[model samples]
Target: MPESIGPRDEGDTEPVRLPDGNLEHLDATVRQLLDQSAEQARQLDNLASAPAGSPFAGFPPGPAMPAPAPAPRPILELEGEEFESEVDTLTDWVETFLMDTYGDEVSTAAPWCLQWQEHEDVLAWLHALWLAYHQHKEPDAGLAGMAVWHRDFLTHTMAAVRAPGGSLSACMTDPDRPAHRILPGPQRSARRTGASTPDTGEAPA
Candidate 1:
């Protein structure tokens, strides 16, 4: 099995080169996770701040028009500590690898090590990783490998947020907000219904 890796970046406000190889990809992935986390935090804040009956109050509409409304916020809350633990665990492995591979110079931050505790990128990765891991069940054939793959993919995907010169944000954004995932025809985000409206018996085109 290939060693699972996440994003790593030089700690400068700009970019720094690790004494070993560059972990730019890993850094971007971690940064993305942080962004998503921040967004989640913002989402939670929005939900918490909204008046009892605003448009964003209930869950937004789902694919099926009659389906249960979307919750304005996630019910199962993930606090900062739980999120950071996973990130920290991943970072620890990277740090250990660096120490073993390059020694004391490895003191540099792996995007997860924060100058400040509440970095949004770290939080986003946590939320994304949590959702991807918890929501998707194993496929038939009882495939056990995907979970690890999923975690690693997310780790790198989320970390790409700090690619030294490229649009790290655009790159990281692709996984979560895919450019071409939207299917053609009918409704954009979801499948359009061919069913009739309640008031009128005629089917809506």
Candidate 2:
């Protein structure tokens, strides 16, 4: 670096040695800068090469969209302890909330069984209702969730489940005259013999 320093042939040609730490740090800094510049240049090139009016043009890639939620499942598919557990929770919702609010006047037309859970059909319908109620109440269900439940799940299910000949009809047509019965299921053999062509498929009936 000084004029006094001679050519390699005439004097020492070894380069000035910096401290090991300082040299390593300087090398790392230079490499990092080069790598950053290269990345910026690649991004710019991508933008320039993008096709006009392309959805990807001039825009950075965004975060991936979340996976869709799973559809609700049937309650009857559960077995053993799982079936019992779900039914317990469903029973709580029915007694504490649903009945307290919507248990209308008992009559022959709109029958409601005092022991509705004993009816297999009632269990199925109420289980479906309970599942929908929870699904719509979730944050993902949006602001109209409860209203949707009332319309799509509640209103429709209530009408069908409480019809005069609905599942509960045989149980509690009149609360004052409460009774429970599971209508006899005809023997499968008899049913098939009669309905095989008769009960099942009548002659163009």
lDDT for each of the candidates? Answer: 0.46, 0.82
Per-residue lDDT of model 1, residues 37-84, tens digit only: 987877787778778878875343347657786542221244587645
Candidate 1 lDDT: 0.46
TM-score of each: 0.24, 0.56
Q: Which stretches of candidate 2 lie over 4 Å from their true place?
A: 1-72, 185-205
- Best-matching candidate per lDDT: 2
Name the top TM-score candidate.
2
For 112-191, candidate 2 gives per-residue lDDT tens digits of 87778777778899999998999899999999999999999998888888888777778788778988777665566644
Q: Measured by TM-score, how close is model 2 to the native structure?
A: 0.56
List clash counts for every candidate, in order. Answer: 27, 2
